[model samples]
Target: MTTSTTGGRTTVADTQNPPGATGGRGRSARKRRAILDAAREVFLRGGYLGTNMDEIAALSEVSKQTVYKHFGSKEALFVEIVTSMTSGAGDTVHDQLPQPARGDDLAQYLREYAYRQLTVVLTPDLMRLRRLVIGEVPRFPELARVLHEGGPARAMRSMAALFERLADEGRLTVDDPRTAASHFNWLVMAEPVNRAMLLGDEAIPSPQELRRHAADGVRVFLAAYGPGAGHAPR
Candidate 1:
């Protein structure tokens, strides 16, 4: 929930210029990376339906044929970018939720996972993609579904598993972790995330503010179903 873990920035850093006389193959690879970066920017701005390869090629300073050679189609390019943006963080989110052990700390694990997820969700480009999906959902429902499956839905599954494991370990009493995880997420991102996306990131919440929201969500969640809640693990 805190900005400490929020991936607020998504700026792809420029690779250092190769020391005198970069080779042709190396140059081509660099160009490919540039193309991917440009494609990401374009997709974030234009969404799937609105983006075109020509603009991406122009932004990447490559010929249209080069773009086609690299990705083949707009959907392919968008899928690749979505995979890149969402998958890496998915791994991190899973890693944050280590398997629950006897006497393992549940609140601590939730806090860590919540913090990491908050960071990933708040990442500017991902945030833009979230907005794009919402705006385009009426027209392109599949795109929204794909993004959800790739992004938030995956995150929810990871959290759900963690919650289920906790219940198994007698740390919580969750009969349906999918619903529980969804509630947990809504609580964590309830304030800052919605404001960030709705306000178009015009006002980035402070780290302190983000942390406060996360902490509050954790507190309330624990009070509801954590350690002392009736229904003990069977």
Candidate 2:
């Protein structure tokens, strides 16, 4: 590498990659991504018990040794995929839920939030994940608890914090924001989420159906939590 000073500004010149530098880190990262992507696809199709490391390796176009080096085990890869669902392996997770009250109309905010929530939760990836959990949970009941506590429960806590904020702002009256959050979640999610879980990937609700669900849930939620509903704030 060389630098020249011109007009009191330093300019970089003749910068180049060192010989024998094969971009090891970038290649490793791409391999890891391929493994995760392949793992997600295989698990979604085969469930945790049925998926194997060789198939994942083959699908990823990486060697079995490479897959083992990257992920260590099938269970480890499965856990990573499951955890990433909540923590955002993608863009859909965070934006699906509402942030703390931001001066939007309560009804409109709730509707939009619920609709996005439904949209995300009802996706093929999540629905397949839910089915995988169901299939695995009977033999490993602890996995059920792990999935619930890690994924949906985390979302509930976030929503509860939003409800608490709404209560503080006098946008809603709520004695128990956790319960309020649960109510709102179940109101919008129960039927559609369950249907997709039990039926198949094709069981997702239509956009019009989702809109109606969100609107109805907002109406019911506001009826209880709206100002002057007068349950006497605790």
Candidate 3:
């Protein structure tokens, strides 16, 4: 764990996992998280081209060689950062959704889910991350793929499952739940995220704005596909 940034070594204690456990597995996981967190900050500030392993190591307080040992290369580290961020962001929200599709509570569940999504995007660090990915995407197509897998695609997959369950219960009449999920997400995020990305961090919408979006999305979804939608198989 002794590496060369900021006049210190990134000891095992610096990791997220608590100190001392069975074997050294817990310590390694902690070290990985520390490295990932440091890499995220570095990537956000420097972009892909500006990022360097030595600098990341220094920022992480792990040695230069230690950075190499953990991530192998700058590109790998960037991918890891994107993967982690995307996982927590888009996918995690869907995972929190009710598995069986509580039709009665659908509105409330969607509202909460929308709020979590908005919170993730509006956070200062995550906002910078989205910008950074967009900026580097043209030059690095892999970044786009990673973002897709971690973000929209992941969310859609989860949403499709939920929608399929709803359809089975005759709460929704979705023929292609995946497409419907994608469309719903677009309706929810298009305006606010577009503005935030364009205006940098300064354009993040207020909580009231997010609440409105959530309400509208839920209303539209229910109107289009909910129980009374005639499309539901009689």
Candidate 4:
């Protein structure tokens, strides 16, 4: 048995499960999921230093010992939370990417792609997470790195891959798929993401607004990259 205090109450857990026990593994996985969910809420609400393990344990319905057993320390838990959240979001965006078929309308595909990216990334939760990570960078530089690698960097990679395929099919003329991906990404994301980040959730755009922005971005991207554009001077 393991005992710990949470919110001035004593909480206990059965710790005697033998190694390689299936039930034990299932229970451990459940506890870990609960801890991550609860910790994300607490950290988002309170920031890093303000958050407490006791609160997380209480909210998660687990003993504080279990939280520590799973995550070791508050710092470790924080890193895991940031990494998990960003990676999950990145995976979602990557998985939902539209499969570009030959002869599909490039402008329509680009607009849909841009709009989808915006919709996935411009939510209140993700925006708040981004701000939170940015604020903590001085103390936890790795958090920023994780956010960038899992979010924008991952998105750019996916975009570049699709662009490469399109260019191969003669739909676009791309000297550098990576650079073109960056241009299209920022063109769709920069204004809206910056607005939401700096001005708060109220600045997040509506679907109609996002659609308009996506259309405009696709137009510019096609002007420079669409077939017959011929690479457009670097």
Q: Could you say which candidate leads in lDDT?
A: 4
lDDT of 4 by residue, 1-234 (tens): 788898999865645545557686789999999999999999988999889999999999999999999999999999999999898888777886658788677788788888888998998888888989999999999899999999889889988998888888888898899999999889999999999999999999999999999999999999999888966543
State the displacement of the C-alpha of residue 169, model 1, in Å, after optimal TM-score superposition.
1.7
Off by over 4 Å in 3: 1-28, 100-103, 232-234
Q: Give one digit per residue, the lDDT tens place, for model 2 in 150-176.
A: 666766786788888888888889899
Candidate 1 local lDDT, 6-37, one digit each (tens): 37764332344355444766788888898999
The 10 consecutive residues of candidate 4 with the worst lDDT sum are: 11-20
Model 1 CA deviation exceeding 4 Å by range: 1-31, 46-50, 96-104
Query: Which 10-residue window of candidate 1 scores lowest in summed lDDT?
Result: 10-19
TM-score for predicted model 1 compared with the true structure: 0.77
Q: Please, what is the whole-model Cα lDDT of each candidate in the order they appear? A: 0.77, 0.81, 0.77, 0.90
True-structure RMSD, every candidate:
10.2, 5.3, 8.5, 9.0
User: Pairing residues by index, what is the TM-score of model 4?
Assistant: 0.87
Which of the two, 1 or 2, has more TM-score?
2
> Which ranges of candidate 4 are over 4 A from the true structure?
1-20, 232-234
Better of 3 and 4 by TM-score: 4
Comparing 1 with 2 on lDDT, the higher-scoring candidate is 2
The lDDT, on a scale of 0 to 1, for candidate 1 is 0.77
Clash totals for all models, in order?
Answer: 3, 0, 3, 0
Clashing pairs for predicted structure model 2, backbone only: none
